[model samples]
Target chain A: MNYRGPGRVRAEEKPMPEILHPEDCIVKVLRSCICGSDLHLYNGNVPDTRVGSTFGHEFVGEVVELGSEVNKLKLGDKVLVPFNIACGKCSFCRQGLYGNCHESNPEATAVGGIFGYSHTAGGYDGGQAEYVRVPYANFGPTVIPEGMDLDDAVMLTDVVPTGYQAAEMGGIQPGDTVVIFGAGPIGIMAAKCSWLFGAGRVIVIDHNEFRLEFVKNYAKCESYNFKSIEDPVQFIKQTTDWLGADVCIDAVGAEAAGSAMQTITGRKTLMQAGSATALFWAINAVKKGGIVSIVGVYGPTGNLVPIGNVLNKGITIRANQASVKRLLPKLIDHVQKGTIKPKALITHRMPLRNVSDAYRIFSDKLDNCIKPILIPPTVKE
Target chain B: MEKIAKGIPDIKDWGIDADPENDPTYPMKPNRTDEEQNGYTWERSVQQAETVEILKSTERPNLSAVFGTSVPPKGLSGAIRRYAYKNSEGQFSHWLPLLIADRVNVVEGIIDDLKKGKVPNIYAEKGFNAMWKYNRKAAIGMIAANVAAVSALGLFLFRGRIFNEGKSVKKALQNYNM
Candidate 1:
């Protein structure tokens, strides 16, 4: 369908991409997801959502064609495409930092390249289409294990690993106190990963009662509805004996929910508290000498950081686009071992042709949809 | 005496000869100069007296502490020779085991690469550089392998004689105890 404008779709015929290199593979998309980041492009809030740019990035597909050097994967093999394009041999890719691959971007200055961001990434088409070309296919695509649902594995492409990274950056160690801000899909997933990592207390803060319930029941994390609580940050600190949370994750980026991060982190500057505190709160809320990992999506303009607070706190900060290639294998193993059931996070599923409707329903929060998996209509039963 | 003379030829090739032309004697005459000839005569006389003294001392080994592992007299010519050869060769020979181990490690690495695929040019270059950097190690490994092979052969050929020598040492010790 041609993207004419916001909320408009039209059927248009376009040439399918062929294998241009020995490492390339053509995939027939099985399942795809509408990311919150994609909503930015769809709503025209973020620039570069052009007429020809395909929309989705979180996707699972079957290999339909393989280039000469594609030996690891074969035709008919099911796989998940990582959101970040990586060459697998570059310095960044070698260190499992696939998001920052040197070759994926045309400019070669920045380390990361996002799918569907033509100006930011390599301008390679996205997985919203029936077929997509994957460069360095063996390194970029993760083969889904047997008996795993394509719907469930699709989240591993972007959100699951992203959430996991958020938890990781928050220093979510076993038996450590953790507070996760924003109970969105990513936030929920981050909370779940923290629980899985064995956090002693995983407290999730959000205004949405439904999301809080989901986190409490499904993720088995302590939930706090910020609207219901008189003082959410103080309450959490009081629960942890005023030491502050050992780890804090901010799943909400620079959105309205992010304003609460300062309060959650005890009024610490976003940078001072480090990326970990920035993950859940502003940098100031982070414990001294603690780690902060920022997994949330920042605007192209970037956030106004409190550099002084970060310097004073001596908090270690790390921010990166999710490296799904490195995280997918471990997440898959966890899923196979029944350590994590990402399927529980899926609140809705609709056919690919109905993706526009699904987007509206998800965006509008209709029927409390958290994550809606989009299955393409063309797949055979 | 005849056996010693036959061994002397083999020893000369090992850089231990004492003759001027065949033995590489010191104070070598460039063109048989008169001064060099006189100096050579004096050195030979001094060396001959020293050799006689060494032979006399060996008759009473217990009285000669230098003949045993005990420290030799400082600045003695023979003592200096013993220290130089023993210390240098002993310290240098210690590297043999390490060299052998490294070579084994390299061979294992090469075998692993061969099993995977043809070794890349980069790997080959790395291997070449590694060998160049540790050439002395490689030489020590070669020497160790040679020594091991020679020792094994000697043990196989002189097994009965080796046993006899062990028995003789034990008997001598027992006699000393009595």
Candidate 2:
């Protein structure tokens, strides 16, 4: 999959990836998925969405070659490569802040290396191809445990960990009312994981009826279409007895499509930092002193946020790229125990050659597509 | 006015000297008689000279002592790895220069605050050290390995491809020992 600028991706054969460092390995990709975040790039929302780069972060594959310094896995090891690249020896990585790895993205002090996101992230090519180079192999690229489905393992690369982190950052206490903004894959997954954190009432808010309905059935959480509600924040506050929800999550980032003003400034005019509408709603709807966990992908530029409310309320806002390497062990255990069905999020699967069509379907939310997976040609059925 | 250190501020400037009394060469008493002034002046000068010498030393800091062994990388390897994977547009074209400017501002801010003799946060100190240290040998090693891997991979990828003969191509391949 070659990115040919905004709204353009071509599925063409490219040079096979090879080990680039003593700690790198070459993986023959089995499966990769199109993330909602990738749509930010497809729609030209993300900065530095370079042409000729492949785009897929959630991937699972078989290691065909190993670097000399890689000591963890043997040849042909089936592995799930985390989206973020991290060196195990970095201060951030040692502290389980793998997503902010100091050794990965020296171009910027903010975001660390991400697979096929953009230059804003470390510009590593993604796994929407026959092969991909896995850096710091021992740190990421966890081997799939026996009997674990490939589809399940693939989601572990990004979605599961991101969703889990969103819920974890919310600091949900028992019987707490947790509301998640957006019914996207991450949003739905966050709602599901909220239950694990002892959320008494889980609510997913979105504008799409299909997604709201999907989350209701899939995550066993109450769902609301914000368009139908009079005012989402007021509604949430009323539902929570006027105190507001204990936790609120913003899973929809820059390309949020709603509110005529935000749509014009963020999506149409390219002013301010992507429509932070969902984030604003999360901030406004959460109870004073409640946690606002954000996993949304915003632009590097500043976003218009209600800082006065944040300051007065003493809300704890925790946001980061999911440190998948840190959470992989526990998430795998959850998957194995059937506590989380990571693959239930998959709504469509197509050959990687149909990536252009797949992107259109998912980006436009056509045919009620919730999540889409790309099967590499090299993978055996 | 504080005596600013006379050196080019690198990416990680940490501190600055503030007191004239801390300088050996600055006169303490100008009107005293030779004999009375000599003894006191000599003593003060010696103490200040030692202090100034300690402050002027330019030894590279040991990151392990401060950050407990998980020291972040301190040189171009971090940047080079990113460059290798990225396309030409994503290279050091725009963002890298901005990052450098940001680092300079942070270091300058640190130096300005150091006049109060207040220790910067441990995280700040660790970050300063990581940015300051020049691990040239490690950087070269990493770059060489990456280049070799890329060249080998390229060769393997297009093994049977036909190419038009050119003197420039021959010279480049010869230079690379291919």
Best candidate according to DockQ = 2
Quantify all predictions' global Cα lDDT against the true fold.
0.58, 0.70
Docking class of 1: incorrect
- The DockQ of each candidate is 0.00, 0.01
| Local error of candidate 1 at residue B126 (angstroms) | 60
Q: Write the per-residue lDDT of candidate 1 for residues A56-111, one digit (tens) a residue.
A: 78888999999887888999999988998776655445556778665554311343
Give lDDT: candidate 2, residue A335.
Answer: 90
Can you tell me which runs of candidate 1 are displaced by over 4 Å?
A: A1-13, A230-232, A258-280, B1-178
Give the fraction of reference interface contacts each candidate recovers: 0.00, 0.00
- Cα deviation of B57, candidate 1, in Å: 89
Residues A248-274, candidate 2: write the lDDT tens digits. 999999878657788788776666558
